[model samples]
Target chain A: MAKEPEQEFVTMTPQQKKARRSRSLALALALAAFVIVMYFVTFVKMDPSILNRAM
Target chain B: MAFVDKSALGDADFRLSEATAADFVALLKPRVMSLVVFTAFVGLAVAPAGMNPFLALVSIVAIAVGAGASGALNMWYDADIDAVMTRTASRPVPAGRVTPREALAFGLVLSGLSVMTLGLVANWLAAAMLAFTIFFYAVVYTMWLKRSTPQNIVIGGAAGAFPPMIGWTAVTGSIGLESVVLFLIIFLWTPPHFWALALFKSGDYERAGVPMMPNVAGDASTRRQIFVYSLLLAASGVLPWALGHASAFYGVGAALLGIGFVHYAWRVLAQDPADAGMKPAKALFGYSLLYLFAIFTFVLVDHLAMRMIG
Candidate 1:
């Protein structure tokens, strides 16, 4: 009789899945923060008058 | 989605070792990164020219990432020695949580990302310093000096000291005497601080085949060197105040702190080598950490006060 090839799958545990999700969330937050900071910096650089107005 | 390959999954020997997010974080050496961030922040904050708050934040984040990248690369390269050392045996790379190849790739990616981001958001000078610091720590220190010379920490300390200069350059687009003074403080302080650790951990260094001061120079020589560096560090600590970069308040505080540092170093120097406790060396090691934090805190406080009053 000829043998058939078997397919195997690897799955993460629930805890591992939760940890991956949290890590992804943290990375997303860090990226968002970086974008926000860059935007704010660009705004300030483009308008020196903004500082005087704040004061 | 899981990135596991189907082919890799089919291998009977393949077993995931439960490496968590924390393991990846550990590869960054968070404690060292925190110190890097704090010192870099102080450098940026104390710069004479004002910077956009958002720009300052970006520079700090970039520098922190660069520091973390250096740490990861160091762990990758030093895995062999780290595995042998009791203190570092549990680090991610050595403990089998993070593979060397993965750590190397992570470090290289982060290093490129950090330098590019810093150059785009800040000045090229700061970015250059960041690149050099990473190279110095990972290549110059970890690959070359660590195994070859007893003066490894002495020269490698420059990598740790460059953050403040990078922060300053990010603001002013140039290095100044003030920033150089900040660099000198850290540069000179490194020997005494690390030598104290080496005194107690000579056995570990010997076992790992690292040429730390105590292992190569003998206890008496290492002790003497610690005292000399402590004296130099003490003088360097007061330079900001002496040069009138900081106020009289900072001067008095720094002087007192320097005195305490010298006292501790003196104790380490005078202690009998055969003594079982090694208390003085331990005390000096602990105090060195406090001394650095307190000095930098004073710098931050003085800078803020000046800004407010002016």
Candidate 2:
């Protein structure tokens, strides 16, 4: 069946693009920090070899 | 109740509903999901050591959700080109049954839920693999390679191939040589299987501005590459037998399927693309799906049988 007609892909304005890029970078850094914290809090103390037996 | 009472719309309204349903289903990409889920399940079922049944169930559900999440995100980003391609024009976002924003949100939620739940229910390693699989499919494949080169599917196929390895990790909580073999089979199989479809649908992709193999490499070169990959696929499918990951049943079964694959590829290579006969290309497309499913199913069943006999 027929659907969306020929609208072009929406191009973001430069300001929006810049803001998005910055926000994404900040979020990625934040996520990395969270991972680091979680690693020590949860993963660091766990023995990895618990898995070797399953293997 | 008030909405139904109004009933001002014509029969065309009902027709549109059916069409919209079809389009939304298409957004899930059942054919692609089938291959992904089947291989992933086989990987889980055939792991060296048994997984807790509940954990295995969770692993499969997570993997499937991750796959569907990737599919949804793909629809969100590719809505523009999706509107252009006849084959894809009716997908959810393109057809307006779902908005790009809605699709994006659905994808993001599914991705997070699948990864986190998988990690909690199974091993962190499998959860991590699930996370990587989502990233690989959504960001690496849909965002990057898809627009860049003729080799897009070649590299992007790795995202699809990870299911077995993820399954292995879910059970074992670690990677091993066996899971790697499972990965290699799908990696080698992807190009030829996809290029066969591209061989015939070159016009569809070319019009959409997607740089698929046929669009970039030209038809003759693409067909030759398909033949080459087909040979490599045949070689890899037999590795489980050679490496002792499986028994004689899988070895013989995979070899037979691989030979069928090569035969169809040879037809595509030798056929006059200018001719009216599209049978060879179509056959290759259909057989490729069966080939992958059969090989993995064989591996799973063989492993189970051996366990029982032993």
Candidate 3:
């Protein structure tokens, strides 16, 4: 019986690498925007008394 | 025509994907999303109650994302047919720039995020309507109606028509007759707009096995239907004024726009079949888009003017 050859990993080209990096950046920005939106939404939903509470 | 099974293409058969961020954006059907956003904004603007600016921004973003998510899901499901249709052949999913699995996951994630965000920032009713709109577009229209029925556009138009109602609910916390009139205008306008495209591009739809009106009912019947729908659409365009929700100024503008739409449709109806160019249908299709935009602009301006006068 003939021995099977092992498969080698394929390396990504520079173009593929750049594409992946850009996609990562976009995802990061989108997630950060979502967080900021949620933060502001929290303030918007809060009662005015909360901000005026005696310290 | 040879159909390449994109799903079957193994990693070994292709190089590493170089799909860009723009490709992912394209999956959102940005053009359609813009119209949804614009209509939703108009709905929000004309509501009896006003929303906080921040919350209004959130509502519009969530609605836009939900609509885009549905579009992504549609691209995922219809990729096979999309590959065959000339108009859709270059779409990210069908063109091999984005995998089906990627598109499905992207759509699902966006759908969840959008619905939750809308619910938290607005009210649950608006959120629920957004969810229903997404489901209706992705499942009912794309998966079921489109391939099986010639009346697909008529029924599926409901999905596109929901954005204004959702926007109204977001601001007022309930639906209103004004929003319903907006919905009706879009609903009645859809058939003539889409059927006009189908008239010109029936070959693309036929090759993709989609049962468009021209392919299923023949050109003559489709043209007649377009003319009839044009009349109804024109009437519906003036309904906000008739119902006293809008001013006479809006009524006049809407009436003129409706007359323009009907004239375009008449050209389509009177066009000779042997001409082969289908120029009238193409012209009607372009004019239909302008008509919708112009009508909505009138609604917004009318609302502003009435508020100032009062």
**Which number leads on TM-score?**
3
Ten-residue region with minimum lDDT total, candidate 1 chain B? B1-10
TM-score of each: 0.89, 0.78, 0.93
Better of 2 and 3 by TM-score: 3
C-alpha root-mean-square deviation, candidate 1: 4.5
Best by DockQ: 3
| CA RMSD per model (angstroms) | 4.5, 12.5, 4.8
Kindly report which residue stretches of model 2 are placed more than 4 angstroms away from their true locations once superposed.
A1-55, B1-26
Q: Report residue B208 deviation for candidate 2 (angstroms).
A: 0.6
Q: Where in model 3 is the C-alpha error above 4 Å?
A: A1-9, A51-55, B1-15
lDDT of 3 by residue, B112-179 (tens): 99999999999999999999999999999999999999999999999999998999999998889999
**Chain A TM-scores, one per candidate?**
0.64, 0.59, 0.67
> CA lDDT of each candidate?
0.89, 0.80, 0.94
Q: What TM-score does chain B alone reach in each candidate, compared with the true chain B?
A: 0.95, 0.91, 0.95
Residues B16-65 of candidate 1: C-alpha lDDT, one tens digit per residue = 44556677788889999999999999999888788878778888989999
Model 1 chain A poorest ten-residue lDDT run: A2-11
lDDT per residue, candidate 3, A1-55, as tens digits? 9755434455677887888888889999999999998998999898888778787
